[model samples]
Target: MNNQTITNTHRDTSLGYKLGVFGVVITLLWIGVFKFTPTEAAAIEPLVVNHPLIGWVYNFISVQMVSNIIGLTEIIIAIGLIVGFFNSKVGYVSGILALLTFITTLSFLATTPNTWKMVDGVLTTNFFLLKDIVFISISLLVIEHNKKYI
Candidate 1:
């Protein structure tokens, strides 16, 4: 490719990457804030309660508190991701955290009861959890991009 073409391609890729990162950051921040609400807390109860690693949290704390804690963690991760835009080391760590977040979310597909069902001879699962696959991919890309600077 000519110099101009290569430069254009690089610019386009960078824009796409920025958009993906922005989407993830927005999603995490919005969901994290929503977790503080009673409705969101209740909605997530089933998933949290069923989680093997985090289910025990409910034993010592109220449902709202548990949700609050998760929400706070998500907010922190989102902030870290934003900062990662300027700091590669922070970005690498934040990307890893974001990756783990989605992996754990995807695990809910298996851990949560009634998450999967057979519909009209087709196997269907919680479509919401499926979105995490894209998030995971983005997180990986973020990690890869930042790794060059670390």
Candidate 2:
């Protein structure tokens, strides 16, 4: 027989977990960086304007200003994720932030239907937005895997 043993630590030691975390970290960092750019701000205008939860932000602050705030928050969360890898309190907060971010992203499906163009009577979403589902699962896994085992 082959030599392979699956245990509770499977998820912790599997390649999927490492790669998933790395990908999530990279994406979050990039999202944080993009929020500072003019193009990114302009690009997100539609999403912010259409969102029912936070769309009112435009009424109080300019899109660029809001974009900057989001960017800063994302940057902080990214740092938290890195620290969480080592078992820190901030890492816990990162898990919360990550979950919230993905929730917001998934909300886009209900808030902004235009983003998902209709093709052959099927509502098809862009890979960029749909990818949040994957991140959501990853964030959950990270939260569980990083928890202290005592």
Q: Show how many residue pairs clash in every candidate, following the order shown.
A: 0, 0
RMSD of 1: 4.8
Candidate 1, residues 1-150: lDDT per residue as tens digits?
356654553454588898999999999999999999999999999998999999999999999999999899899989988988777788889999999999999999989999999999999998978889999999999899878666
Those runs of model 2 whose alpha carbons end farther than 4 Å from true positions after fitting are 1-13, 120-122
Candidate 1 clash total? 0
Q: Report the lDDT tens digits of candidate 2 across residue range 53-75.
A: 88899999998999998888878
Top-scoring candidate (lDDT) = 1
> 140 in model 1: Cα distance from truth in Å?
0.7
Global CA lDDT computed for model 2: 0.78
The list of candidate 1 runs beyond 4 A from truth reads 1-13
